[model samples]
Target: MTRQTGAGAPGSPRVAGAPARLAARFSARLEKWLEAERTQLPLWLPVGGVAGVAAWFWLPAPAAWQGFLLLAAALALPGLVFGRGGRIGRAVALFALAAAIGCGLIWWKAARADGAALPHAVVAAFTARIDRVEPLPARASVRLTLHPLMVAPDPRGGAIALPGRIRLTVPLEDAVAGLAPGATLAARARLVPPPSAAVPGAYDYAAVAWFAGIGATGKALAPVRLIAPAPAGGPSLWLADARIALTAHILSELPPGEGGVAAALATGDMGAVTQDDNNAFRNSGLAHLLSVSGLHLTAAVGATMVLALRLLALWPRLALRAPLLLIAAGCGGVVGIAYTLLTGAEVPTVRSLVAALVVLAGIALGREAMTLRLVATGALVCVLFWPESVAGPSFQLSFAAILSIVALHELPWTRRMFEKREEGHVRRLLREVAALLLTGLVVEAALAPIAIFHFHRAGLYGAAANIVAIPLTTFVIMPAEALALLFDSVGLGAAFWWVTGRALALLLAIAHHVGSLPGAVTFVPTMSRLAFASIMAGGLWLALWRTRARLFGLLPVAIGLVMTLAAHPADIFVTGDGRHLAVRAPDGQVALLRQRTGDYMRDTLSELSGREGDEAIALDDLPGARCGPDSCAATLVRGDRIWHLLATRSPYRIDRPAMEQACAAADIVASDRRLPGWCRPRWLKADAALLAGTGGLAISLVRPAVVTVAAMQGQHPWALHAAARPAGAIHGSYRRFSQADEARHHSRNRWRD
Candidate 1:
């Protein structure tokens, strides 16, 4: 027996196998939660994601409680679905299909909702703190969310209410720049629905106001005064002040560049790092070092747990579950919440914080985190906490990144990476590099869809910059920032600030150098809604479906690729006197337009649009152009069609006879305004159906008609503008559908879009 046992131990390896087997069994048990979660958790993820958006669809026009209602519904779906089954595969499938249904239903419901065109308007006196004022040559835009106390609606509307729109602009750009978020001032202004005439079928002023929670809109119509003693107060205010103070303290000790960068990494203030330094950081893939995101949060948590556990170890009775785990979790929450508030409550920060809390809660409850319920719980908390974020980038991208990381963590790869024990730090260094690169790729790929749709530009070198910067920041820079800031308050911050400033300088230099390279960023223009949806769908399919189905995911990708290649705007406008045509592109819309032109617009369109090119034609070069002080126009001939371009509205109307001649011969007409006699004008953004030689003139509105005149019925000639009374003229169109035609097409019945 001894011989046999010795032989088994030496050859069969059963002696070592016992411990290995136990570890394997434990891991498998956790993974096999497929069966355990079969009932509800898995089903909820897809259901919940859909419910999230659907709830958005269900929001009331004027959006009263819509956010809360929809978010609740979405939050509830995951739990309902997850508990229905014990099959992992079945749960996943259920959720996947649920996701599809949710997406389609959301689109349909939103398309069919009650508020489309807003008939109501508000006039208010508002006071707000100036957050940031961005300046350009001609226009200076101010972003100020309203303060409740100062806003009061006129007697024409109900007394001033919640959701008043803030005054976004004031005349003076320079003075406002110095004003911080806590500053307050007041303005009396008229708030009305955004006219449908300017942009048909797009967001109306009222609907936009609702989503933004702005009750009224304002421009400085009266003199502004700074009310002294009006300062930031309350938890939100205190947190913000603390963040600023923290940043200031941190920069006091570090060397200049190093200090600045260290401060940014710690406090999310990238203001001091110059553009060149930023570029170098990017090329080196250290950009994440600048933002306090998942990595930052996780590192903080890890550090906290380690330190806390060591403290707890000193007390034997305290080492067990309840007290120890409870304290641990609370500490984690503190780190997450404090960091979130300090970072201005950015969407990503909230998302990560919620996610961290979910896992922590699971530990407190003595359960596993991999369960679908936690995911659902986290999502619901976020929506309930801040519905506005549901419509933004941070929540979406942060969750996706977290999900991807979770997926990889559930796989064999993570296990392998963590298995090795090393005598020195070389292998650890390699592991860190690998982890950073993998994380970068996953996050960038996951967010590419939303980023393209929303921001338009991709940080192609974001990964490279992160690799170098993250470590420098976590180990050396962040400490320097804290040290600098602490000393700076005592009139000693300069030395610390200088010290950290140098490190930042190095990283910034790297980022700038890399950013300057030929292909640092592959510029692409913002695409159509269809294009954005298709791209997102493609990405989703690639990410979610089984490996075998991934190839099929490329179908949408291909469509998006083709669309991106062929994409171009239908109309171009120029000022009559040969000045640049200022067609508005959101933050990054001018990418394609930029490719045709050179360095146009102020501030590179704010990194939102990635498309830029050099095919623009000079305003003067176009023939048959004339100019007036307010507007400019150039007559452009596309093929055989003669198109007269006009900009800057003139008080005088066009000559009736010439207008008649122009309308008669014109194959297609596009304008910023409706000309007289153009009544019952069928409108669309991209195309006009009025083909030459078919009927006298045809107009094809690419989208469904927002406003339509059943028959002229001999209304006033100014009725041309009358028909343009906005779609669902008496209601909020974007918030909900108000199809007048359906309402009146057949009397004695209710109507829905």
Candidate 2:
């Protein structure tokens, strides 16, 4: 009777079965999603790898134990998840494993280098072997990579063992002009740590310097003298020699500007290109052509393969017996390797070479050479071998350009468009032109956001510029240049070099003409890090996914655009040295406190404010401002309230009348010197000690009475290692300002003057 009563309840059976049914439905959905995503595992791997590298950079310098724990967790979580869980877990496991590999790789790279950096701002004499020399155009300096043999304060003292490399900017006078790699040199130099980020979210020169094994940067205090002939110039030195020799030959053969472009194309030496030419290339969106990257690698390799095949066909005896395609691909691989070495084996060149090698390998294996899988494999290899590349613009932009091109070609609509047959010569020609334009548009669209994010500028005429530039470079210039280089190697290619120079002159002319057009470049203000991240994520999603889900990626893109548009420049900006200050006037023009000092910082601030020129008014010209020999006092009117600011070079000197007047007038005082104890309680001071830790500051006038501030170094990795400055100490003084005013008024007013 009891069993019957329980079973007879109709709702009981349904409720008991509900949990089982729901579980089945959830499992089925997860399986379906995983099946859909299975083909995208390669795409996800790079994403995870990038995330791992970014996480490492974002974190403070981790201790040995912490780094080890991260490596362990990154490795172990995937195995545990895959072993115990379902399809969804397996996908996550794959991503986790890739991330783990990335984390471990970077950790290992960092761990292997145990040498400490040179003490900052120390002047000493060092005997160093030149590893590399880069000549600066339009400057009387040569940048030398030095391997220190000995360092001392005085040449007579015992040598100090210095580890790692030093980047020395030596004056290119008689003593150093002939300097080349492998030469030993002695010089007195002042070494300092690499410069910190110029502004918030700016480039991290310190991290880049650290990863490059360059512990410090310096300028020679004395003329560098050759101590000895370079000790057995190694393979790298030979390569450098060859590049320099090739560049010199090219320059000798062609016109000044034209020769620079030709040499840059041939030997990866863009240093000779003038600043005006650089601006033209940048504005015309043809700057990538100046660098040896995927385009150069592909063109060179493809030309080598085609020429090899053609030559083989001419000799039927060899063509019949040999696998011409495979042989050609092998030849192409060799050429790619040679070119990579010639170009200094830079990260971008290496990446391009790897990808080209992968394709050549595929051809050698009798498989299709071009595929997303191969591209992903090349990127993963680059990341594993050089983890620091993940933080670089070249790696990001190169990969982005390649991935976007591949993704666009794989699109169903684009494939269908290409599959259609043209009926006539004119129609086919039109189709070819359309294809070229489409390719340029796709690459430009992918790179535009990134360029804006980093450089804060976009080429308005980039598409039009590329339409003419790409075909000319790809078909005419690069092919001729390659042949010229090969012929010049054996000393018989003057005609080819002449042709290449002509083509380069034409290319430069195009760049100049395009760049000079109205509104050729648009300057965008800097955006938030989060907004940039979202934009990048959206771009990756759109390029990586093959399904309709890619449409969802547009959401983040829109949000990023909105965020960027709404962003505002800071009202007041200060440099880390506490020597430069910029305040936005009511009319929105940026006014400088010191007109001469901090030109770069001021120009950057002006660009961020959407100003076209680097024009700044003097502090003396502003209303309610007074300037003395060493200090300046100004009152800023925001809305209905007046906020006073005092900037002084000598905080130690207390001129009675000036000090009293400043105290009565100013709300904030910034100086390079430490503030006096008597005045500290009354005025808000940003002294040298504070500026050192903060890097820089941006103040926002929230309202007439309320103000908010943000620091450039806020929560960044560099700040984590920097000495902590107490903002509370400065704020505390303000709290007791009124209470302590009467007690110290008379004594505090007694200035030295």
Candidate 3:
């Protein structure tokens, strides 16, 4: 194996061509394996991530440690690649070492941040420094991370009033830190959730806090109290200034009327973006822009690089590649620092800076870093910095999408597709447009299943909106934004800010219009983990697999088909008795008698055929044929038998003997009764299951099957099926829910409402 050495001597082996030699060392099989790894690596990451999610699903918290381990193995792929020892093996060896250290650090932070059992609220004389500011619409809130100097639980053991935060915004921070790099403040605020319960097995606030280095949360009890004005107010405050700046600048520039959305997209101040704006961004498939991701960083640096290269090329004396490379690296650092300051240095922003640094370093060294290595390095760094982020959506989805892009784009055909095109400014511009659109599409499509399973909604039209707006923003808006920053820094905001805002407004208008276009997005109410597996796997194969074989392309398609088939359709066919909702099963059987009806909320579900719609007649009515859990029930009308029931103001009259027989042989029981302190057989909650074990609404909803039920006597017979898992110490914690009373019951953190 030829080693890449730095020393130059005739006797010394040539080290300059190590990269080429390394590439050549591969056998056809090794080459294929590497290519496959590139393709499969991304696909596997999400698959592994989902698997971790599934393993801990239904449990109270995310298994951050286990999740980190799985991710570590994935990052150590190069070592997994080089099973044998040789000079080339060392490259993979170092990669694995980095991966290990990164994972180890994350594991430690996760444990420290895991204040899962800490009191939610506390009244104490605590001082929480504003770590960063999240941009929001009407007002802005500073993210106050506490040092946990004191912890006093409330006597009530219910609510804890810890501290408060000030409404620090972009302009506000500039006003506060006008002349200093690091400023200081003390505040008392209430830190709580954003008006909804976070999805289980997806994003855990507690886990998120660990990575963010937060122990407790609350909104500011009053305005912030100024503590000091040192450079860092101490080393602690100094550490936070860079992160806060990036988000602050973008917020400062946006028209105050737009709410937090303008700043959110411009920078990574998600706190500033309102929920509605978040929804809009999600629907528009432009949410990535708000995250301060590799895309944004790359765009910033690339623009600077191109300009630097162009300028440097014009200089006859400095035509050597090394100088251009050095200049690019320097420019990248400048832009990244400016960006971080502007966007408010967030975890994502810091990670992105690392990625930008890699790009810069590659240029400075005059060596093209393999895109995968850079991705791996960024990932390793993220792990080292915020290990708990392994369980965060930002970390999981961002890394997954980036790796997918690297993997898919690296496909020879995927690359050749562009290479084959003609060279020219117009051609290049068109290619850029295509690349941006494709990039958005790939990420959206890849993340769609997870988004649906965790939240809900597909944003069907987002791809088109992105395709239209992305090119305009990348070429027109970003450049203007950078130029505006320079002018503003040079005391030209009066001119630059106006020009920049106008250009930004134009881009925003394009996005809004494109997003407003018909069929821009569709909301899918529900989905399952299996569907996530299928979507990403399918997307990877479709983008990466090199085969003329038609069947290969169809593998992922087939997997999706199977998953969709298994998931009951979104439309709920509620039965009179809650235990038996008509769900279109995957086996093509219309078992119109099942109780799990919440599948209606799952946006990803699709009925196999006429199972739900065609047969639905009434609640208390039975059809021509008698069909029960074991046999058929009496008809609601004069007809033979129908799958329908009747709602009554109170308990309804029923043939005691017949009902008793049905109950005796009944495989499930359901009721809408709110009465607690009673136990019943396989209970149901208004046509939904109420059991401690299997076949609950969530499980049944994910895998809808036709279940035949017996009868319902009491009015609102569905109430009779309300089954509470044999009450015990853990009963309240694992209680199942139904849609009927969902609006009324508010679930708090860790347990049901």
The prediction achieving the highest TM-score against the true structure is 2
Each prediction's TM-score versus the true structure: 0.63, 0.86, 0.61
On the 0 to 100 scale, the lDDT of residue 731 in model 2 is 37
lDDT per residue, candidate 3, 65-133, as tens digits? 455556656645665576554333433444444544544454344445433323323434344344444
Q: On residues 1-753, what C-alpha lDDT tens digit does candidate 2 reach at each position?
A: 454336447657766788899998998886776678678766788787776776665544466425744664765576565646566666666677677677667767866754346544677887888889876643556788889987765555754445479899977673554578889889988887766654454455766776777777888888888888765557887889888888777778788788777777777888788878987898899999889898888888998899999999899888889899999998999989999999888888988999999989888998777778888888888888888798777888898888887888888998887655947888878877888788878888888778877777778778778888877888998888778877877898888877888888899999999988988877775576678778888988887777787888999988998898887656666655677776777766777777675555666666655554356677777766777668877767665445567787544576765575665545667776666644441445666666655555555543311121223323333231444563223333343234344344434432221
The worst-scoring run of ten residues by lDDT in candidate 1 lies at 690-699
TM-score preference between candidates 1 and 3, better one: 1
Cα lDDT of model 1 by residue, 1-753, tens digit? 445556355655787687899987875674465444334444256434544453343332324334444444464466456645434334544454454444444444434433322234555566655443222112333334545455565567666553433434555542332345556665565554333212211122333344443444446655556654336477766665676666555545455456456656676666555454554554444554666777677766656766687898788776754477678777877877877777776666667777777788887788875444565567666655554455555566666666665554544567677556764798787887787788767766766666655445466766666667567666555556557656756777667666577766666666677676776765454355577667666765554433444567789988986897675432332211122233322222321111233343322332322343232333344445444433344444333333333432334666565444444333223333434554221112111221100101111112222222211111211112233342233122112212542233234221111
In candidate 1, clashing pairs total 112
Rank ordering of all candidates by lDDT, starting from the highest: 2, 1, 3
1 or 2, which is superior by TM-score? 2
Clash counts per candidate, in order, are 112, 1, 95
